[model samples]
Target: MVLNVDNYHLKSLDNLDVKCDITKVRTEVIFRQSNEKIGHGIIIQSKHFDRVAVFAPFSGIIINRIYSVYVERIPRDQQWNEQESGTYWFVPSNQIPELVPISKYSANDRELIGPLVGVVVSKAIRFAFVWSPSLGEGICENHENLVIGGWIKFMAE
Candidate 1:
C-alpha cells in the first residue's frame, strides 16, 4: 500500500504518549526502490495484542515490500474495541521455519522467531508478518523507514 504525502499524517516519536525506553529501541531501514535506502522507522509493540504503533522519521510516500501483500484497509474510525478487529495478514504457503537468521535472535527470542510473510506500509506504518513454526502467527508494525531503538513499553488496555 502507498500513502501519498498530501493524505499522510506524521506522528512524532518524541510525542508518543506510550511509555517506552527511547534508548532501547531497534531501527529498521525503509527502502525506496530495490536497494535504495529511503529513511528509518521505529516499531512499537504493545504488550497486549490489541494495538500496535509505527513511527516514521520523516514525511514521504509509504510503500510495502513485494514479499508482503495487502490484506485489507481498515479505517481508523471503524476500528473495533476488541482485539479480533485487528488484521493479522498471513499466508500459509509462505510459511518457512527459521526464515530469519539465528544470529538475529537473542536468548529470549529463540521461541519468537519464524518465517517472515512480508511488509505492508500504510499511512507511514509498516505492518509485518512472521509465522511461528511451533506457535502460530504474529504481526508487528514499525515506521515506514528503519527503526532505530529498543522496544518501548506501552500499557495495553
Candidate 2:
C-alpha cells in the first residue's frame, strides 16, 4: 500500500471529536527557522489494537520528507543502528516513485505510503516511519476507530 500525502489537507483538530491517549504520549522538541523554540511534536497512541492516528500539537507546513526502509533482516550482530540505517537511505519525497498524488496510486499501492517516510512539518508534526518484517509497514498513527472517522471526513472534503 502507498500513501500520498499530497491528497490530504492539514485540518485543525479543534472541531474534531478525537481524544488522544495522553498516557502513551511521546514528544520531541521543535525549532523554527529562526532557531526559536516552538511547541513539542506530540505523539499519541490509541488504546485499541486496531486503530491508529496522529495529531499535530501545533500547526505548520511540511518542510521536508524522507522515506525510510529497514534492513533488519540481517543478523543482529551485523545490524547497524535502526535510525541511522533507515534514515541514511531515505530518499526525498519527490524522488520516491511511490509518493505520488492519491489518485495516482493503484489499489495495491495505496497502503504503501505508511512505512515509506517521515514527514517534517516545519514547526509542526513530524512522524517517524518504522518497518518490521512481521508487521509490515503502517503509519505510526494507527488508530483504527479514529482512522475510519478521519478518513471519512478527509474523503468527504
Give the root-mean-square deviation of each candidate in angstroms.
17.1, 18.5
Name the regions of candidate 2 deviating beyond 4 angstroms: 1-80, 83-89, 92-99, 106-110, 113-132, 135-157
Indicate the TM-score of model 1.
0.20
Segments of candidate 1 deviating more than 4 angstroms: 1-85, 92-98, 110-157
Tens digits of per-residue lDDT, candidate 2, 33-126, equal: 3321212222111111111212222233222211121111212353444343231111112221212243544434223323212221111133
Output the number of the TM-score-best candidate: 1
Task: Enumerate clash totals for all models, in the order shown.
Answer: 16, 17
Per-model TM-score, in order, reads 0.20, 0.16
Task: Provide the global lDDT of candidate 2 against the true structure.
Answer: 0.23
Candidate 1: C-alpha lDDT = 0.26
Residue by residue across 19-124, what tens digits does model 1's lDDT show?
2311111122222333222123222212111122222232342432111111112233643431342332211222221123335544342232322212122222
Tell me how far the alpha carbon of residue 57 in candidate 2 is from the true structure, in angstroms, after superposition.
21
